[model samples]
Target: MLRIKLKWFHSLRLQLFVLFFLVSAIPFMFFASLTTGRIEAYFLEDSKAEWMRQANLVVSQIIQTNNYLKEGTNYTIFTNKIRELSQSEEVNARIIVVDPLGYVVADSSRIDLNTTLLNTQIFNALNKKNSSERYEKAGNFIMSTAVSIIDKEDNDKVLGAVLLSASINDIYKLLEDMESQIYFLSLIASLVIGLLSFFSSSIITRPIKTLMKVVQRVTNGQLDQKVKLNGKGEMAELANAFNHMTEQLQLVDQSRQEFVSDVSHELKTPLSSIKVLTESLMCEEDVPVEMYKEFFYDINSEVDRLNVIITDLLLLVKLDRTEIMLNINETNIKHLIANILKRLSPLARKKDIEMIYEANKEIYAEVDEVKLTLAISNIIENGIKYTPEGGQVKVKLQSDMQDVFIEVEDTGIGIAKEEQGRIFERFYRTDKTRSRDTGGTGLGLSITYRTIIMHTGSIQVESEEGIGSTFVIQIPIKHV
Candidate 1:
């Protein structure tokens, strides 16, 4: 249960959403509170300052008006003047007068004086001096200001003080409106930021999800599938890479399938032939003595072909190991071709096909002589089998001081241009229908290719359909 809960909490979309709100809300809350407090405080202070400025003006006029203050120590006479000042449009504020000993002598509000003598509003106003302001919420929210006064005759002594207060209900209302605006803005901003984060995270995770699905399909052996993406961003690049990987996988899969199918087919044909020949021999009640040599020769030839195919397959396996190296020797090209042609000459003569050799003596090359000879021999035999009766096949060896050349040129039905390049691929027969009649396991050229590569040499061919073929082998002196 704990693990499941933890996993749910840590899920990508959930975590992203939580982080979006968390990152957006905390700072927004802090800034809103700070800004609102500052604005509200500013409004309150301004309200108090405005009220105090008005109070200073009214008190100045009252103290300057000696026409109403000719009395002795009785500040009540100024009440009518203060009341008139409080009621003025220019100074719409309430006024109060108090003695230094803490008694309310006069009030514009006309509250009961004896009962309000103990009021701190009057006492604190007397205690206050200069020009400053404070706040109160008596009857309504109000700002208070105080200024001291002196007697006209004895200007050195503070006779009494003026207390002024003003209502600031509008300021409070303005602050409340500002807070409401901030609340709405914060909510809207949070929602927008959250949606942006959600979409960004989804955009990031979507392509990865698609690539994972492609991987799943590939693992299940669907190699022909390709990814299609139209974006021009990082995701598109990743998709392209994934598609390239799939392309390589498809080619590898095709190669493997063709290899297996060809192996089975090749093996079955030879096995069936051997079985048929053996069965025919066994069913013979009285085998002719003369026919025995032909029978055994045919069987031996079949066995030789099978052995060659197996040997070539094993050689390919060993070479594929990445650790094997060829045993190199400096071999004579002219002598090599001559010996091969001599061996295959009987087959050529049986069909009345001419075997020709062209040589430039003193041709030497760096090679694994035995393997090189096998490759050349295979090429020679291929040409012999394909060449028609009376058609000419040539084995040519020509050399210079720089390199040696071996060429097997045959007058026979040649290969198509498109199929020429794949001739060196293992078990690839260009004409599948005629593969058996050609007496080939299709591993001959593949083996030849590997052998030539091991010798650090090159092989190329030029052929015209229905005309002839000339396969050229070029080898440099001094093994590299």
Candidate 2:
């Protein structure tokens, strides 16, 4: 039982319920005390008033024969009348006639009838005839009195007191009994409320638990794992979000696995060819001397393609881990773009594509010279690769107070809308056929995106199929 209780307290939902029960029960227990007090007060007030009334009846009867209470002549008759009245009911009653000076002339319940009642209580009552109530010193009794006496008129103006006492053993006993009953009820009530609260908490937390399980499955490589929480409300919205995330994640994982397999195949194809062709060339008897030159050139080109793929893959790995720190300087943007254009102008000339810079004005910004140049170069290079003869490639630089912008535009075959969103994903190629024939590694845009972002910048692409594409980069003017 103790271990079970400990486990209950350990559960978050049950713990909350137990704490709520304790806090609520405290106030409820105090309220029960007040209720019991009111019950006791009401019982005592009504009971005392009724008992006082019955005791005063005997006093009223003696007042009718009140003359006997004054002198010794009829004292015996008065005592007999009081005794008769006292025995008539079960209420303990005592009649004591004390002189204004504290002499006990008669006491109905006192067997030694003539004993002097010189107690301070009797003197106090005789001195003032109005009634008063008090408890016994022992704390066991409630005592009250109604005092009436003969006025010195000898016609018997009532001058003595009637003393009434009721034992309150039952009042306190009743309060204890009521307390026991209330505690029992509270215990039962707490158990019931705790159970209800536990069930309610479980209901509220169930959807979140399902989400956790789904995320765990996803983490364990089951990227297709999805949760269903169809209850109409915020939980439903969360479930929808989880499903959407799961779908996107599954797509990403499939693409990543395909990318690895593609890399292996791409690397293996060239290496296998080079190895076979080289071995054939080494066998002088199998290969003709005329074919050696072409074979060596083809092997070198394949080696160059392999080297480029490995280099792009290495750059991507470095960017992904953020291990490459930017070595920044305050450099003139005008000089940088001029240098890049100069290097690429011969390629544009060879293809008859127009290479142009929109703005000739000097722009200044704090940036890493190598990374910013690389980002701009990658986009422009991509533009140069895809653009046909007579196509146009343009570079622009501009700035505001908060940011600097670099935009590369090309009148080349633009990407389809469906492919534009994943343009920056690693190993993602825009035109699969063109990418394969041109031997592109597909990490150019991905590396450009990561490098620009590392400088607290954003890169975006605007494109329409068969029209053109513009790649824009916005970098903060100041760096920390």
**Predicted structure with the largest TM-score when compared to the true one:** 2
Candidate 2 lowest-lDDT run of ten: 1-10
lDDT of 1 by residue, 4-121 (tens): 2223322666568768977998788788889999998787777767776787677678677733433444445566787888898887777776666655667788874533453555
Clashing pairs in 1: none
What does the lDDT come to for candidate 2?
A: 0.76
Angstrom error of the Cα, residue 114, model 1: value is: 60
Per-residue alpha-carbon lDDT of model 2 for 1-480, expressed as tens digits?
111222332377867688768876777778777888888777777667776676667666776775665455676687787677766665555555555555666666685366666555566556554454646657675645655454555534446666555566677788779878887787777777777887788776677667766776677678778788877899889889889988988887788898888788878978998999888888767566569988998899999989998998888788878567788888888789889988888878988999889765777888999988888888898898888889999888888888888889999999999999998887777766787676787778888999888898999899988788999999887875
lDDT of all the models against the reference?
0.76, 0.76
Instruction: Quote model 1's TM-score.
Output: 0.52
The best candidate by lDDT is: 1
Model 1 misplacement above 4 A: 1-198, 232-241, 280-300, 330-365, 394-407, 433-435, 456-458, 474-480
Off by over 4 Å in 2: 1-34, 37-166, 192-221, 283-291, 322-324, 328-334, 360-366, 436-439
